[model samples]
Target: MSSRPEAAELGFGDIEVGQVYEIERSFSATDVQAFAAVSGDHSPLHVDPAYAAGTEFGSCVVHGILLASLFSQLVGMRVPGRHALYLGQDLTFRRPVLVGESVRAIAKVTAKSEATSTVVLNTEIRSSDDKVIVMGTAKVKVRDQVRESVAAASAASAVPAGAARSVALVTGASRGMGAEIARTLARRGHAVAVNYLRSADKAEQVVQEIVAAGGVAMAFQADVRDAEAVRAMTQQIVERLGPPTVLVNSAVGEFANRPIAELRWSDFEDHLEYQLKAVLNTCQSVHPLMKAAGAGAIVNMLSQVVGGVPPNGLADYVSAKTALLGLSKAMAAEWAEDGVRVNMVSPGLTRTEMTQHYHERVFKMEAARTPLKRIATTADVANSVSYLAGDDSAFMTGVNVFVTGGQTMI
Candidate 1:
């Protein structure tokens, strides 16, 4: 560790918009070797001087990713400090960085979201000669250390015995966006029911993680497409956690993007079962409980594809998701008098286990199309869900919030 003070030591509460931080370091040949050894990226441009000498740079150059890694150090150690999660980043390489060149990395807070405890920073790296090597923007989630402590103390003093917080049921929460939403709710003092279909072990793991973090969570298994199963699951949650006042319909089935010409009718049915039918089952099952409570929030997960379906395929998936948008609006209108608010969150090409196989291609395509120049992450979608599930959006209903990095503006 360099003699630099950590971000936590500097205190995040003292940070402000436009505040800047800088760190200077030089990447040595030894550092390059170590990076190569650890990352398995021993390319001729980085390691073979003989080959590198014939290239345009005329010398070995440090890996671009290696240079970008400096931004991580700047954010975690200098700016937001200890409790920071690097959510997303957009980088542009201005010039090649050669080993042993002293470089300065700078981060400036451009925007801050107090509701989410996240900050967006402008980032740049320059050589000692003042030549910019890399430039980009980064979004990081930081913990409000001081505020959290005060809130925790206040909550401890305010609540009465056996007075449980609101309950949130997140479906398909064994992993990906669902799991993160469950955890986020728990962190906000809500009792979370982690719903899963076949991933019992993974669901249990999510519960364990929440419990370890001092949050209340329990895993429940059910095939969301099955109405009977969903009803049983809701009953179990009611008995254990309490009636769920906030329900997030996030469970989805596998999508096969076959051309419309070759797609069979069953393909459409399959998606409907998972998307439309599942939402119907979950909503109907929880309607009574929420209606009786006099107030509740329901968040349904839709895909950005509904905005404009990709031509490559997924007609079945797109059709079903389009229907979900209408369903959300109808529910909002019908449930308004029942004191239940319904909303939708649509994400575009988010990084999740279901999309891992095509992660690289999808990321490149979506990032190029997105104005933010980055794909959405699980945390990004989770943050939107949290917003709609909480009192911040109490007056909002029948709205479709797109967490698509501006890919789907409508």
Candidate 2:
């Protein structure tokens, strides 16, 4: 028997229900075309826009099977791997996935038959718009009695209020992925300080919901760009929720979708203050507390736009986020010896209040531009952030994980 973690060791009986599997994969134009060629699924629906234009779907629809294949990509190498056997799958297509759309596949364990060495999982395929193009269920087999037992026990001893949940400070928790991240951290037994700058009402609502759900959370107001305010907020949070070991910098100033020619220097400075400076302030303020603890995870919200394919009017936003990547790497290098891990999550176009405007004007056009034809959702990005904040990414640092739906391949 190996002394390594269940995830690292290979065995059969270790499979357990209630575990979740997720991965963000980009499908390139070549990928779609390749899969089409190999699978002989060259329906005009998948290959030819002109042929699909007259159909009910109105355009070239991505092959459903291609999106579903992402489920295999998520688990095949990361989970049970070669030892696991795919027993069955059931898919329900909700919307047409168009070519070039980047898709994210998610699977959650719904049932288990340890005796039979089988685990059943519910699966989902979501477009960037946060719409479910397809959903289904899958079953796999694994072996490992002791690992399974531990999994079961952890599930049974669910984290309760006042219990041994970790503490996480989440900035920009008033809406979108920040709010979802706060809720998820609470659910996973983390006492959460839901931080918001201007949205006190939304922050309060998140706190209420956490408490209502039998978790511990408090709303704190602090503008991350203000160093003094951030320091003060850290003190208050420590007083309220213990010293936070997890920090998620999710605060981003709104970007005016105007051309650079139409923007002023102040607009550029404002974006830098909110996006880049805010990250710096939080990381600097939290360093002492985290170093004393000898363990911490800090995640900063970045944008995939920084990778490539600049949008119409987001130069300031893009510039600041690009700098954030460098900040993340520099912090990781400086703090790794202290056992602090820093990482960046550059989420693709997500469906949020800020994006509803884009959704109205260019959602379809944007969808057509990517391999997985859609935008990401708050939950999509939130789930990934939680994993990075959790113990799962204990070895991960200085990496910019793009949650874009196959938008920028390189």
Candidate 3:
């Protein structure tokens, strides 16, 4: 290990907007070779001078990540120092760094989040000639072990004061699990928007219930698969209540068990349209709004059938849910640094209106197989969504909470 002095740690309270810090260094060929050896990036343009000379760069170009690694040092050894945990980085490589070129990694605090204990920095690396070679934003969570632990413990029981009265949008809230989720969120101090595509009467009834219970809520009609309709409904919601900072995706179509040979490809497509397509539209529309607000939560509804041992004749339903699971993870990874979280709740067979038609034996068998000796209820799934939407799960993302009564434990 190199004998470098440790930088002073800066707490969350110590950070401020416009504060600047920088580190100067010269990268050599040996550094490139060492990085390549560890990273396994043996690209000719980075390791072979002869090959590099033939390219437009005309020299061995340093790995973009290798150059960007300077920001890591700046964050860990300076700025927020040892107290900082790097969350994510978004960068643009404007110019290449030639091997042996001297450069400076500069960091300036652009924003800070007391709620999340995160700080956003404008980070860049410049050549000796003062030309910027790389530039981007870096987000780091400033950690204070004792304080964080206490806050986390308290959050488990109550909502963060700042989250009170925040707006939530729950799709397919006309009835079923969606209605439960909307009502639960409203009880947790969120003004809710209950969305339904066609069941206007039922949606309005859910809204009226929330209002009678001294909560704010309204019904919206939109085919979530239709992007334009979703936008229009969202606009109306913003005008009436507020831009939703929390979204619960609970939209789904009716379940019809059919053999593969008897089903058309359109059958599979329809399931995807309801489950996956709706999420895509809502997420795209609300992401910018969430990013601007500096905090958001998206709880996607999935079925534990994807956990394993999928039943027969559910190819369409299971396949759509699996795709949704993957998409939730991808969105979680992409949006974490924005203080926007995406999580999935996959509950075991629940007895809602959707499954009311199933034979009594199906429910009995499911409950018997589960460790809890009972199938899930709409309340069980809705309660889990409430936890994920609240600040108690602030640091969690890219996670699938199996709310299956210990039935699908990994």
Candidate 4:
């Protein structure tokens, strides 16, 4: 078995359609004989070599049931995991499997029944050559259990909070994913400095919420586009939160869906100022503090469109993000020796207030196209940032983590 740890037991609430899990196994002739002895299917085609040699198969074949058994492992050991109980399964054998042939069994969730607490999975068994060996469907009901999404996500990467110096600075944290990143870092025991441009009230609200949750936080207002203002804000954060060892660059300009013909150079310039320039200012402001600490993390928020196909009207947004992405990689390369790691989180079409301009059909189309059958959530992006901002990713630098729910696989 792979050394990867098991996932948390999933309840109906935690399961999403189009989610997938798989396992592999190679059947041995000894295993076939054992099944033959147990099930009493001693047919020559399956057990007798000479009797089968004259037949179309030319050799003994493993029982279809032995291959289908992997689906049970898929349901019982993964996805919904230990909490799942089989409701039913329908199978269609597509090809024969000879002994010692390796096959991978895959299960993908197709539907969820809220009323019945059941999940339907499209199941398949494929040969090592990528040929479909068997195809089937399974219906499983998950046992009720509490969902611990945050805990499970952090289990792999989180360090002991009290033992680590965790001070976080999240820019544009007055609302949206930024606010959530601030809150999440605080929850992970970081003293959060919430940076905002104009929404002091919203920034203060985020700070108060963190305080109420038994976490340390403070709000700082600064125009990240101004290098001097960013440096000043860093001084304030240092005085209060002990200098930010974790910096999240999320201060971005307002997006507009305008075509090239309808746009001005200022439009693209505005995005570059908000994205590339603001990030540069913040990174410089926090670099000295992080270098002094001997270890630091920078989580740059970027968009998936920069790496994939861009929509017609989003050239400005895409261009800005592209520049930011390149800058982040360069920083990661140059700053590694200084103990400051730079990484990026690029999320797909997330349903946030900024994206309210997207039409319902467009939203649905994106979700349907995604492998997970849904758009990225703020929590999804926030969790990725948290992982990159922590000790779990200590050895990682210059990597881009995609929070796109498999929309843009790169």
Give each prediction's root-mean-square deviation over alpha carbons: 20.6, 20.7, 11.1, 19.4
Question: Which candidate number would show the highest lDDT if scored against the true structure?
Answer: 3
Q: Write the per-residue lDDT of candidate 1 for residues 35-94, one digit (tens) a residue.
A: 999999999899888999999988889999999989999887877777787877777899
Candidate scoring better on lDDT of 1 and 2: 1
For candidate 3, write residues 189-242 as lDDT tens digits.
898999998899999999889877767788999999999898777766654565
lDDT of 4 by residue, 1-410 (tens): 79966755877777875588889899887888888899998877778778878878877788989788899888988868878888777677988998778899999875553323556677899999899989866767777644334333442233233423467999999999899999999888798889999999999999899878877788999999999898778766654445578999998888788989998989999999988999999998777556645679999999888776787998888999999999999999999987899999999988877988878998899999999999988999999999999989999999999888887775
Better of 2 and 4 by lDDT: 4
Lowest lDDT 10-residue stretch of candidate 4: 155-164
Winner on TM-score between 2 and 3 is 3
Tell me the TM-score of each prediction against the true structure.
0.60, 0.60, 0.63, 0.60
Question: What is the C-alpha local distance difference test score of candidate 1?
Answer: 0.83
List where candidate 4 sits over 4 angstroms from the true fold: 1-165
lDDT of 2 by residue, 51-147 (tens): 8888987767767788888877655655576556676666789987766667778877544442244555678988787788788667666655665
Question: What are the runs in model 1 whose C-alpha is more than 4 Å off?
Answer: 1-164
Q: What C-alpha root-mean-square deviation, in Å, does candidate 1 show against the real structure?
A: 20.6
Q: Candidate 2 deviates by what RMSD?
A: 20.7
